[model samples]
Target: MSNLNLSLAMGDYDRTRPIYDGRVKIDGVDPVCMLLSPEEMFFRAFRHQAFDISELSLSSYSISVARGEPHYVAVPIFLSRAFRHTSIYIRTDKGISTPADLRGRRIGIAEYQLSANVWVRGILKDEYGLGAEDIVWVRGGMNTAGRPEKIKVDLPPNVKVEEAPQGATLNAMLAAGEIDGFIGPRAPLCYDEEHPHVGRLFTDSIGAAEDYFRRTAIFPIMHVLGVRRRLADEHPWLPGALLKAFTRSKAMSDAALADTSATKVTMPFVEDNLRRARNLMGNDIWSYGVDQNRKVLETFLGYHYEQGLSPRKVDVNELFHPATLESFSL
Candidate 1:
């Protein structure tokens, strides 16, 4: 049998990729293409990169881009996690209570293109009656050293925008009263007694999603895996084998979770997390078998269009290949 080549999309999160990699080895599948971001997936798929999705009308690969297109061979395989944009945080001493209080205040974000920053800005515009012009915007770098791209948005004329160095530095700035509020992911804001200065404005992944859905009726598809559609079609048995491997790996993850001992966090914890993820996400993670996934795609497409990130509309159908449920029924 010829080896199968696959590509998976993953983020900075520690668990997802490690778990998938272990499963891939156990299942004996070979990965050929692997890009990290949903944005990159969209652009690469459009450009027909090494393993382009656009070239294959029927192949078994996973394509995670914004929600309006269909994949002939790929399937919407996972919910992954509910990623939220800014956890609007204020210093405890600032006494800012609500989103409304943030007007004219300074806000720090990781970067402009980062999904979290984009979603946060969208929420501020659609929900809080604040546009980009209403606050002082500060752009910070990522975890490692490098400057982020300058973001341009349609804000009111009064808002002043600037850039900073990093999230940790931004956190320091917040502590020093350099910024009034910080808009970033929830993980960054989870501080304890040692760093008690920050207070959460709200934990609103669902809220931001709801607002985004109300306007576009779609959820956002961030990180996704992609495969060269043509290759999978040539090897008809490839898709089923790949899906089966993932499913078995998922099952292994379950067994692993059940065996976890309190004294030591074994592979079982990872398995347990995978099992729970499967239960919570259902076929969304392995099969992409939900209408909600489509909604997310549509919403993301609209967002890109409105933001001027892309000049042309991306039809989901054109981006990925088609596959029946039975293709990933395992």
Candidate 2:
């Protein structure tokens, strides 16, 4: 039988570039890979089901899974992960010194269902007793005027959410102090530009993130690799093949990043940061497989349900394909 040809779409991270450049191959498959931004890849994958395999937002995937039969099923290849402590940006003038201070404040979000926001909110609630209902949420794009949640979400009634005023954006709103703060994956443009008043809520974000990890042991997952349900069903081996290939790609990237003689990435402190991460989280810092990440997945699913993104708490087993849940050991 001939190898199956499939379309694959995901962000162009070093971990995935090996697959894009043909150094890593999916078993029994010919992949047509498209390097895309997270927004484009996710919107097309979830909303349109446009690719055979693509990167999916973990929060959005949970929502789809909770709503019943979804178009895609996920493998255990976590394409993106991060500590969301750095995601929160606040106006310095606001008296918001701690996460608890966010209560009764207006905060801007691109979308409430965003995985990063979900993690941030979960962290706030878990670490500071600040629930989603405690704040008034203003929804809009960070730089642009309007942005809709890629997957429709019906949040709990008590959780207040409002649209940004027409012709306004979260970035401008944060800069003008219209919104007390902003929380999402990417920092607001004003914060990046060093606006005097716009600064991260955690002034020492790295220190905060390190402390958070020390306490929780959760390096939050943002994106999961997904295959069309129909395709996975038709070719039972597809999901496992994807998991293998992506894991190999990540290993290659890790090896390159660890090569200190000539740093692989453009970042200045690659070796120092890599040393610190390994010292804190061990060698397999960015691990794949369900068994390795079950706790993190469980935590995110709990948050997803509590925050009203998922209709009900989704099981970690339900979030990934059975084939990916176990593997043949050497």
Candidate 3:
């Protein structure tokens, strides 16, 4: 049979490089892969169904599923995961030395329903007893003038969220101290330029992330591989094929990074960082597949429902294709 031709949109991470370069190939498919930014990829994918396969926001995907209007069927091959301790940045002058200090303050966010914000909010509620009603949220683009949440959000009546002032952005407002803190996947450029007043709430983000992992053991997942629902229904075998290929691609990236001769990534202390991560997270720190990451998925799903992103709590099994739930035994 002729191979399927599909468009795949994803970030150009080391783990996905092999597929991008064709060093790793997807079986039974000829992929037209384009490395795209999350903003472009998710906007196009969710708004227009622009790609056959794409990396999709976990929160947005859950919202779609819960609304009974799902356009994408996910695989367990997670494309992005991170510890979200570093997502929160606060004005040092706001008396916000601790997470609990965020209560009753105005917080700026690019989108109230972003996956990173969802994870950070969950951490705050679980660790510091804060909830949606505790703070006023300002929503706008991080840099541009206007941005909208890709999915609809039915927030609790008590949660206060307002649009940014006309012609303003969250990044600009944050720099001017118009907001007490900012929470999103990307830090404001002003913060990056070492602005005196803007600082991460967690001064020692690495240490804080380590502590979070020790307590929760969750490497918060940000993005999931999504296949168009119609395509998946037409070809029941496609999801499994895609997952196998991505898993192989990630394994190749892992093996390359673990090699001590020279370095796979252009960074200092590659070996030391790898060793540290392994020591903290075990050998398979960035693992893929359903069974191996059930706890992580379950936790994120809980937060999705709690934060009102998902109308009802989504189940881990409902998040991925049946073929991806398990693999044949060796």
Runs in model 2 with CA error above 4 Å?
Answer: none
Candidate scoring better on lDDT of 1 and 2: 2
Q: Candidate 3's residue-wise lDDT over 5-112, tens digit each?
A: 999999999899999999998988999999999999998988999999999998888899888888999998899998999999999987899988999999999888
List the global CA lDDT of all models.
0.49, 0.92, 0.91
Model 1 earns a TM-score of: 0.59
Evaluation by TM-score, superior candidate among 1 and 2: 2
Deviation of model 2 at 242, angstroms: 0.5
Model 2 per-residue lDDT tens digits across residues 278-326:
9999999999998888999999999999998888889999988889888
Q: In candidate 2, how many clashes are counted?
A: 0
What TM-score, computed on C-alpha atoms, does each candidate reach?
A: 0.59, 0.98, 0.99
Q: Please report the candidate that would top lDDT against the real structure.
A: 2
- As a TM-score, model 2 comes out at 0.98
lDDT of 3 at 303: 89
TM-score of 3: 0.99
